[model samples]
Structure formats: C-alpha cells, structure tokens
Target: MRTSHKMDPVSLTGLGLGVISLTFQLFSGCLKAYNLLADARGMPAQFQYLRIRVRTEQHRLGNWALVANLTEQSGSLSTSLQLNEALVQEVLREQETILTSFWKVSHPHTLMIDDPKPGPVSGTEGEADLQERVPQSKSSLEDRALRFVEKMRRYPSRIRWSTFDRERLETSISQLSALNDAMMSLLDSQQQYKFHQAQIRTSMQVLHLNKKVDHLLQLFQANSMQLSMAQFSQNLRLLHSMQLSAYSSEPQEERQTLATLARFKALNVEINLDSDDERSNTSTGIFEQPPLDPRSCTIFSSVPSSYSPEEVRSDGIYENIPVWIEWKYYEPVLHIGHVDPHTQVRISRLSALLSNPQKPTQFHTPSCIGYFNDVSNYRFGLVFRRPIDVSSVGVPSSLFDLIISNEKPSLSMRVHLAHTLATAVQYLHSTDWLHKAFRSQNVVFFTNPGDTDISTPYLCGFGLSRPAQNTEMTEQPDSIPLYNLYRHPLAHSSIAVDGKSGFKKAFDVYSLGIVLLELALWMPLYRVLGVDDRNLQRSLQPGVTKKVRELLLRESRYLEMVKASAGDVFADVIRACVEGFGEEGESLHDKVVVRLETISI
Candidate 1:
C-alpha cells in the first residue's frame, strides 16, 4: 500500500506547543487510526488477531494518554515535560510521522477537508489553522481524533485490507508501539520525580504542622489557660451527664431502659473507636466484602473421615502448625435438604466465589469451601477447584515445609510468591485485621507439597488475628526464639509507643519481611543467621534487645543474598518491609504490596 512519504506540515501544527501536548496530540491521532482499523467491517475472520491487536494498541494508547494527564488542558504534565524538552519533542515528531503512515495517501491534497473541526490549534494561526485541530478540551481531542480517522477512511472505495496490507499495518503498529514505549518511559521518570517531590512536601507539611501545634500548646500554657485538665475533665463529665439527662428527658413510654442505654453507650464507644482507627489508618478500604449471614451459610457438621488434616512445621520451629484442611463434596443429584431459595442462592454464589475468585493477575488465594464447626471449634476449609491427588506423593501443605524440604520453586514462582504474599498481607491489613501470626508456616497451598504452585499461596493462621480497632488485651509474647524470629523487635516486648500491647500492622509487615527474606534466600530465618534454635535461644538470654539487634544485623547482611537471588528492586522491597515500610507515613499497601506488583520478574 502506498503511504505518505512526508507528514502534512499543516497537520504537524495540530501538535500543541509543549512536548506533553504534542505527544498527546500524536497519540490521540494514532489511537483514532487504530480504532478505525480495528472496527473496520468486511475483514476476513483469519485476520481477526490483527483487529484485536489494533484494538489493544488503541486501548493502550488511550489509557496512557489518560494516565499521563494528556486529557487535561492545563495539567502538571506540561510543566513536568519541560525537564526533558528536546527528547520528548523528538519523540513526538517521530510519532507524528508514524501516525500519518496508517493511510495509503501519497500526498496531503489526496483528501478534501470540509468544515475542518474546531479544536486546540497550537503555534501560528494562519497556516497552522489550516492544519488539523488537536484536542484542547477532552471531548475535542476525541472529536479531532474521529476526524483524522474519518479522513483516513474516506478513500476512492472501501479499503479492502489483504495480506499485503498486513505487513505495512503491522510495521506501523510496531513503530507506534516503540514510540509509545519511549513516551511511557519518559512519563515514568516524570511520575517518579513528581512522587518524590510530593513526599518531600508532605514531610515538610507534617513538620510544620507539628511545630505549629507545639507553639500553640506553649502559648496556651504561658497564657495560663483556664481550661485546666481538671476543669476539662469536669466539663466533659458535665456534657456526658447532660446527654444522659436529655436521653432521660424523653417520655416514660419512649425512653429506653438502663440496659438499653448502657448497650447504646458501648456501641457508641465502638463506633467512635472504629471511626478513629479508620481515619488514622491509611490502609483501610483497600478490600471490602459484603457481610454474609452465618445462619444462612452452608455449615457442615461433618467432614470426610478419609481426608486427614496436614501439619506444616518450620524446621527451626518445632511447633507443628495445623494446616487449614479442605475437601469438596460431589453430589450431582440434588439432596433437597433445604427449601430456602435465597440461602441456596447465597451458597451457590459462595461456592462460585470460592472456586473462581476475581483475583488480580498472577495472584492466587486458596478458596474456602465452607465453614465447618465441631463441638468446640469453628474453622474454614479451603480447597482447590481441581482435584489433585496429594496421597500419590508425600507433599507438604505449606511454604514452611516446602522450604525445609530443600525444594526450590522456579525464580518466576518465587517472585510471584513474594508478590502475592505481600499483597495478601496488604489486603488483610486493609480490612483493618492484623495477621498476628503471619509467617512462612501460615503461607499454605491447597495443593500437595511435592510440586506445589508456590505462586498461589494463601495466608492462613488467622487464629491470632484481631481487628485494628479491637480493645482486647494482647496475647502474651511467646518466648520461643523460633516464633520470635518472625516477630518485630517491638513485638517481642508486646509494647508500643502508645503503651498498647498488641500486634500492629507494622509488626505483621516485619513478619512478612522475614518471610520474604526467607523466600529470597530459599532458607529459613534460623538457617540464614547460621544459628539453630539452641543458638537463637542462647543469644536471646542476653536480653531480647541484643538478640533483636543480631537479627537486624543478619537481615542487613543477607540483603546482599536477596539482591543476588532477585534483583535490586526486590531487595529494596524487602528492605522497606523490614524497616517498617519507611519512616514516611507510608503503609505496606503502598510501599511493599504495590511495589511488588511493579516488579517484572
């Protein structure tokens, strides 16, 4: 197919003055061209892949434009683009050239322009106005894009695409893809710069706010404020009494009993606490699910006697952690046990959700089949949809067993393991539940241990998990060095700065870091430090402080091994986790989980 040897100089003026605007204009033009090609009719079914590919490129370009803030008329991207003006401008010009090659026009005069669309025309007005309009308004960009698309489509006859045209189209697509890649790389650099600047500004703002608060407090104290602690307490008590009085003021028939009032007061406290916790926590609301009624749920009173429960034991830690057992029932014929359609529907949906979770790409979690309650205990049974014989080979059910067995997952699987595990923890934290027992032992697989898909790990061991806003007393610290190895240093004492005794999300993050460290090196924590349980115990005798310091040192030293195993990026992610996800008010969701998702390996 004959194509334009040179881009119309008039059309070139459609690219705006700034590099980002110009790049966006060119991208919009390409996206429009791809959409037209993709949506073209009468194409043979054999060439459907080409259409799919063109549509994919169209989507990619469109998404990139949105992400790069190209849709905004006055965006920060314009200012950011100034930093790399020459390179960006060159890329834009190249894109502009490649964009014109989509059509078979050898000359700019091949197509007649009638009522040229009105859009943002950059540069000189006289000759430039004759050029195509670029998108100034978001809608205008799309409109102008369609105009280019229609212009390309208006040939002598409907363009019958053949195998001959495929090569040229593919070439143009590839060139456009390459140019877009370059533009995205530049965009990433700009984004990183902006993010860094934002972080610095946030830090400065926090500092300033802290100083202002401190100054205000000092001034109030110096002025001998009448609102003393005792007076404030008295006033607060008075308000509380007044509120109770108001409640009591209701008609005798309308007023609630003391029991109801007390219950309401307790609920109010919980509501206030939850709200405060949610407001203070950055990780909340990442994952939300509708609550299901326990009464309506399909509860199994009995499980298969043939299927024995598995235990995963960490080598250094002799404690045998009971694996969350799973088994599925196959009854093609309806049992007709219950008549409630809504309950059945809920069960069916639950089964479907468990079997086919709407999970992120390359991320997996073991599906919980249903809840089973024995006389004394209630537990969730997790299952893999496909039945695999675990009995054929003695397979370990958890990461702890897998690691101890000296069988290493492939590099890709290891990377995925780290990522999915981190993500699972993030989701857990996001729901305001802290996985107090997060470790390799808790990271289980539904499949057998011998050849388990490490990529699809499920975070278990929720027996110790608790809500972030819960005021329950923290469990006593386990003196076992094996368990302490996974615990954060502060967690060893079960004391926080606020004098609260509980595992925070930060503690869980530290545990995750240890698990990640073990994954990277393909060794347990005790082995990494060249110390067995006995050695660790002896080291712990000289105060938990010294032992914690040793652990920190080991973590730092083994970081090189992590880098050697997985690249510097993975190592940095590990470091961030171990260091409490950085001092900047960042959460594991932002620092560790999202960062892991970005790692290519």
Candidate 2:
C-alpha cells in the first residue's frame, strides 16, 4: 500500500482517459461518414438504368479527339494512352447500349425518357440510418446520370394505358436496362467526328450497298460503333415509320392520329347524322382514316397574330386564317400534310386535283413526294423529289430524341427563341389575346437549309387558352381549373390580364424567361406542379414548391452545380429571365429585350 501511494496513479488515469476519448472520437467520425454515404446510396441496388441514347458513325467519328489528345501527350498514342482509350471505349460501349435500348423502348413515347429523375435526396424518417461512409460503390457510380423512366405507379406509356398492356411496362424496363448498358459503354467525344470522316473516305473501298441493316453491320465490321451518315438517316426514317404504325395500331376514333381521327369524325357524323331526322346536307364521311391514306392534325406553325387568324380552313375557322398543313410524302399531291411549317406562309391543298379512290371523279390534294429544305424563315423549297418516305409524326419519334440530345442550344439560341416569343407576345398584346400556355415543346425550330441552320419556330396552340393585353387575363376564376400541371406559376397568385392584373409586356417577358430556361434546358420546371386552383391557392402545398425560382436565385447548391456546367452566357440569360422577383432582385436586368423583327414563315 505504501509503495502504491508513492506511484503516480493520477498520471496513469489521465493517460487512460485521453486514449479512450481519442478512440471514441475516431469511431464517431467514421460512423457519421458511413451514415452519410449510406444515405447517399438510397436507390435500389439491382436497378440498371439508361441515361440516354445517341447513334453516331464510328469511322466517321472515331478516336479523332483521342488521337488529338494523344498528339498533345507526345505527338502519338503512347502505348499507355492507347490502352486507356481502349479501356474507355469498352466502358462507353457498355453504357451507350443502355441509352440505345432506352431509345428502343421509349422511342414510341416522348413523355418519359429512361433513367430520369432520381429519387429524393434525403431519406424519409421511416427509412434506416447509416453511419459510415461507403466507398465508391460500382452501382452508385453507374447511376451518375439519369435516364428518366416513368414512376412505376403510372402507366408506362399512353399505349400501355389504353391497352392495359402489362408487357409494355416490362418491355420498357428491359429496354431501359439495355440502354443503360449501352450508354455506359459508348465514350467517344465530339472529336470522334474526324475518325468517322476519315473512315468515310478510304482511298478505295468495296461497299456492299445492300439493305440498311447490312450497311450497319458493315460499319460494325469496320470496328466502329458509329453509324454511317446514310445509315443513320435511313435508320431514323425507319424508326419514324415504326412510330407511324403505332399510331395506326391505336384504336380508331381514339384521336391519336388523323386517320383514326377521321374515323372518329366519321363515327361522330354517323352518330349525329344517322338520326331519323337526317337531313344530311354535309358529307358524313368527312375526315376518315382510310388504309389507303393517313391524315393527322398538329399545329404546324405558331402565328404571331395571337388569338385571331387571317383565314380559316375546313379544319378550323378564321377570317383569313393561315392554313395549317400536314404533308404525306407518298401522296405528294397531298395525302398527309407535313408537321413542318414552311415559314410564315403555310401551304395546304397542294394536290387538290386527284380523284378519290372510291369516287372516280372526286378530287384530293396529295403532298408531293420530295425533300423540302427551308432557307431560314425567309424562304424554303422542295428541292429533291426522289421517292421520299411519308412518315406521320410519331409520338416519341427519334426527332424528339434528336432534339433532346442536340437541343443544347446556346445563349444565342435562347435569345432568338425568347425574342421570337416576344414578337409573338407583342402580336398577342396587339390583338388582345393571351397565350395561356407557353412551353418548350410548344416552341421549336423550323428547318431552313438554304439561309440559316434552322428557321424561326412559330407559336401555335391557343386552344383552351386565354387572352393577353388589355383583356381579361383569364376567362373567369371559376372557369380556371383548380390545378393544371401546365399552368404558369404566376397564375397561382396573379389575376387575369385585366389592366390592374399586369399581364403586360413585362409579364410576358417574365413568362418568356421561364420558357427560355425551359427550351435551353429542354425540360420544364417541375417545382410548381399545381393540381388545381385550390391547390395553387394554398401558395406552397404538400409537393408543390417554386423550386425553379429558388434555382434561379442560386439558393440551392446542387442546382448551382448544374448551372455552372451548363455555361456562363446561357446562365446569364437564365438569370435574366428569372429576374425581378427575388429578395434583392439581384438577378433582375433592365435591358430592353429585342423582339423578333418578324417571322417570315
């Protein structure tokens, strides 16, 4: 006991406590990090997803960039870099398949892209807690990008909903997984275009110019993943045809395509006119979808005239409503009209001289079969008339895919789109009309090959609409649906375009700002998804919040990241569009935004 008292027990105790404290701290930190990592990896484990699909010509787009990068490294592909390229391509090919299959599955519907909209960031209170950081899990990294397959609860596609097709959803999931695999595997940069070009011009080559599938196979034989330009275009045309058949396959009188729509109308006529008091002055066989011909209706061009039209056609009425035309290439005399609006001047009734198949003497206007190129909104023409294929616009055609992939329009593109929209607004204001619904899909490019890259897109649908400028902004409060997913956010609080309501140029400009971001992003803002006037009336409801506004404000960090990568000039335009509504209004700009001089088409 005497010897122990002499010993330094206090010092020993202090040392022991310090060691325990340090150990506890280390364990606590590790546990916290592990929890965060686990939280981050909340998605399901076995779900392989597709991000997007893009078909390119490999020889036409080979490792030209990699070749350039190789030259930068040492003027040639070092043995190591070549290995890296090979490895990268292997990975890319694997991923690109994911998107390709996604396209195959969703090629029929544009509403949903594969692997889009990752689940919520924060796990709900009911979910389990993880306390240690997980290493970069292979599954997690693979899901870096989103493909946007729809929610499981909803019908996978319109067709699926109509047919109650259980297999469609399963097919969509499988196709999406395959697309995801493709996307992960395909990794060529834009510079790959050079190799592709080089492959296009081999001093001499024996091309087995047979079927399109053979051409693609030959390209594959050349050790290229990119499709030859001709094959690419041809494939697109084939995909377009498939889309058309989908429409035809849908139930008649379903109002999906014009053929069925005509059948719908014929049925309607039969219903209305087949009565005993049938004084059938009009033809009951109007607008019928026949096997011999396919007809469809879509607003080909958006006119600047606002609510009023210069002329009205048999399709609809206007004093001098500019006709909306849909073209069928096979019957160039005008069987089905093109959705492509030529310019300010839309031409319908091209072949008003053909005899109806059944009526030996009746006339019909058949669209001329040919390639029509536009020269800016200034002009356009049907340049070549080889046997052009007639494909009705498909619901989820590759055209939509192309736009989704290539619609990375620049700031200049946004400016042009915004200004053009402004011009439309100015016209609407002048006409005392309101464009109740303005969106990205509603605005598009007119292809004019001669003058510029693409002609100005016109604004079309004013149906189920409102009036702008010096008019009642809305029809009536009661008439307003409580919630419309497509309604503008401001309508949540603001009244109609009544003088005091302030739906003026500035208001339109505000709306245009949202639209500009929409087109620039090629997606709509999802934050303010109101179900009705009542839900919207609540200001901020259960799932509805104005996230886009906060995004424009830079309050959220992750979105800030998305903004940074998208580009500066483009970001500036977005900021400008979202201006004048923040706490300090830091994003607001005072520039007198230009109006489109005029839409020539």
Candidate 3:
C-alpha cells in the first residue's frame, strides 16, 4: 500500500473528478406549475374551484409548464432541472404581488377604543315591548347546555379513566375551577356597578340585560339548556365528534387532523389521522363532578319594571330548565384618545341586543329591548365559547405529519369555501349588519358541505357581534389568545354611521380574502410566531403577549414573506395595513370609513 501511494497522483486526480461530479449531480426537487387538474374528474365533485399551493422554496424549476390530467383530476408533477434558486424566488415574488391587492388584517396589539355610552331606554311600554320581542325560548339553548352538562357528569368515572391520559383531567379541573371562580366574582362586581348605573337615567329607550337576570335563567333552564360540569364535559364530546372534516388552505397537500377542543380555555383535537379516512367518532372520558345551582348567584337589579320576554320565559318557572342565558356578549365602546377616564372603554350586552334588529325584545322594566352602556361598569373583553386549546394543535408536530400527505386537499374544495363564504357575507350585508367578529370558528357547516342550497351559512359566536353603527371595533391589545394565526388579521376597525367612522364592504372583502388565503395556504400564512395563547394573552399575563403584529403593515421579514406568498392582490392590502395611516396621515381606523365612502357597496 505504501509503495502504491508514492506514485498514485493520476489516480488521486481521477478520484477528485469523481467527487466533483457527484456534488454537481445532487438531485433538485421536481416542481411543475400549479394547475387546477380537478376541474375535469370522475370524483363526485367535492368542490368547484381549482386552487393550488406550491411551496416556493420547494418548487424551483420555474420553467416547467403546468400539465393537467382532467380525467384524474390532478396534475402529474414533473420539472426540467432547475439550478437557479433566484429564478424560483422571482416566481414567488410575482405571485405575492397578486395577493397583496386583496388581503389586509389588523395588528394583534392594535389598541381598540370603545365609544361613549348611549343613553338609556324607559317606560312601561318598553317593558311590554321587550316581552313581545324575545323568541319563545324555543331552541332551549340553555336547556341543552344544562342537559349536556348533566349527562357528562353521570359517567365521570367512565370518562375520566377512559381517556388515553388521565393527567389532563386533573389539570383541566383546576382550570375550570379557576374560570368558574373568576366568572362568579366578576358577575358579583358587575351587578353592584349596574345598580348604581340605573340611577343616572329615568327616561330611556333601552335597558341593560343586567336588570332582568332571572329571565336569563329561564332561557337556560327552559329545556335544561345549562350543562352540568360532567354533562358540559359530554357536550364537549359531542363537539369533538361533530367537528368539521375538511381543509381550506392554499396548498394542495396540507390537510391536518387536529382534535376538537371543547373547554372554555382551550379546545383541540389530537389524533393520528395520517392514514385513517373513514372518519369515525373519537371520545375521551372524564370523572364526575357534583351538580351545583346558583343559590349564591347575585347581579345588578336596578330595574323598576319587568321585561315582557322575562315574564314569558319565566312563566311556570319550576317547570323550565333553570338555565342562565349564561351566554357572553360584547359591544364596542369606541371613544379613542378621549383622555376622559369616565369614557375610556366599556363592556355592554344591552347594546348587542339593540344592534340586532331581528331580536324581538323591546325595552323591559329593569332590563330593556334596547341598551345603553357605561365604561366604568363593564370590562372590555370577549366572551369566547370555550377556553383556549393549548394542546398546541396549531403547529406541525413533525415532517411526516398529516399536513403534507398524498391525500392533501383539492382546488375545488378551496373554491367552494370562497363561494360559500361570499354567499354568507352577502346575506349579512343584505341585512344592513356586519359580522364585526369574523373567524374560522364563527363560520361553520351550512347544511353540511354536502348540501346545495348554499343559502345560509350557520354562523356561531353571534355573542361577539357588536353594533358597529357609530362604533368602531378594536380587538384586544396584541394577543391571539383563542384564535388560529389565519384569523388574527381580520380583526380590524369598522363603523356603522354611513360616514361617521365605520367599516364598509371592503373590510369584509379583506377578511374574506384572508380566509381564502387561509384555505389556500393550509397553515396560517402570516403568523406572529412564538406568541401563542399560553404565553400571549392580554389579561392572562403581562409581557408574554407582545402582539406579534402582521408584517403586511411593517416592512420586516414577515412583510417580505407576505409579499412573496400572497402576491400583489393581497400584497396591496398588506401595504395599506403597513402604512397604518390614511393618504394624508389620517388614522387607519378612519381609513375604513373613507374606503366605505368611495365604494358603491
């Protein structure tokens, strides 16, 4: 061996050449142009539009043409060797330009201002009016809640030991206890505050819901709507089983199977759906908890008269489900920069009922059909349906995870989402009302994606829909506590008075576009990473919730990514949010007002 080394220079040179060739031969990933191949397929046509999401980083062969096989409803991906990463970036940049024109969302930390309180509602006629308006407590929303809670409680031991892990059960109980305690204390304080409020006015048009507290119980109890802890736990199970099984993102291959969450602090689905397609129910059990009613319940009672709805719902009280309209509602108290401590912010449920013209109630004795709010009494906060799902379901767990599977979603499904969302929004707009709070959860199955009327999209969380007439909606400061990254940006400023500072059809369009982007992108397109619910809530913590603002407004790396991925359509929209000001330094909050003015819609 030593003798051969002395004269092997030529051999060594050959070895070097071989090494160089191998390095140069590294295979580049094959990328073909994204095409709507599903438009022509034998499948039952699950969707209509042809949306596709191709990772710019992975698809470098920009020269390749998109070839579609309609019969297969898919494109056979192929590509010419692409050595230039720059060309791929360029292609992505071009696409971003298109996205910019359509999408715009508010920064999470953006400070929102609730306006001054609207006066009040008065008169015996108001009381009678309220009675005539409320629904027949027909849906028995509260009754359902109570029944659901009770049912879950019955099988506590079976449920608790049945789950894959029993540790979460103990922890969840602690959290639920904390939540219950906090809510009870808050309610007590709010009632005391409201009693003082009724004194300020004698003759008014609306009433605070606080005045008619018993009526709320009537609704909750009507059909045993209120759920016991265990039963509520069971309802959680129902929600899990009924969770939607579809994807609406940009990529054609990003379908994830997260768990369905039911707790108030959080909700998430954690299951291995990598190969399972049959879609069956997955249930987790919980231990039992005792049944408890509000003998200790206390709230505001300044009303001199009774609301008609309350009397009706309270009719034959013992026979009804002792539920609490335990529903949470909010109203924007917009008076931004007013410096007046007495008028800074507020939380008012009365205003919520008033805004919805469909509500049958009129001003009642203590509580009214219409409402007036005060900042000092109610805190400005959103009452979510459930707690935060901190199981961390939003992020991908691994590369081989279900998100990037061969069974990825299709374009037609994407298009159907757009069309359906549009149809739903059009309906709300037609009613002269806007869904100030828009998000994925807010939008749900309208006749089960399989249905065709496509007429009415069942929108939940109406609890947060506020009256934006003269009010401007401002989300909490810098936190995406109970939201997916995709929905953070749709939180923006809106108004009601044709021109008195309001959001117009365009804002709605922007929200829809972001939603479209969400469906197309699969994962949240513009996430304020590292700022999730656990460490990023306004009230939950002090410095943890740093408001991971969207870069569409700020010129950061995120903004670049937004431009690169969203293209020009939504890119332009990002520019607007980026500027953070109107054409002449006007507040962007007011920009929505101006935008509404210029558009016919």
Better of 2 and 3 by lDDT: 2
Which digits, one per residue and each the tens of the lDDT, describe model 3 over residues 238-343? 3233231222121111111000001100100111111236222322211111222222222222221121111111101111321111222233446752223322
Pairs clashing in candidate 1? 395-449, 396-449
Per-residue lDDT value at 392 in model 3 = 22
TM-score between model 3 and native: 0.26
Q: What is the lDDT of candidate 1?
A: 0.46
lDDT tens per residue, model 2, 6-124: 11223324533212221112212222222222233223322101000111112111223233332211224434435454343332333233223222344464222323334533344
Comparing 1 and 2 on lDDT, the stronger one: 1
Off by over 4 Å in 1: 1-396, 495-501, 533-546, 553-556, 582-587
Best prediction by TM-score: 1
Question: Residue by residue across 341-380, what tens digits does model 1's lDDT show?
Answer: 4333323323333333333222234444333222123222
Model 1, residue 229: distance off in Å is 62
Best by lDDT: 1
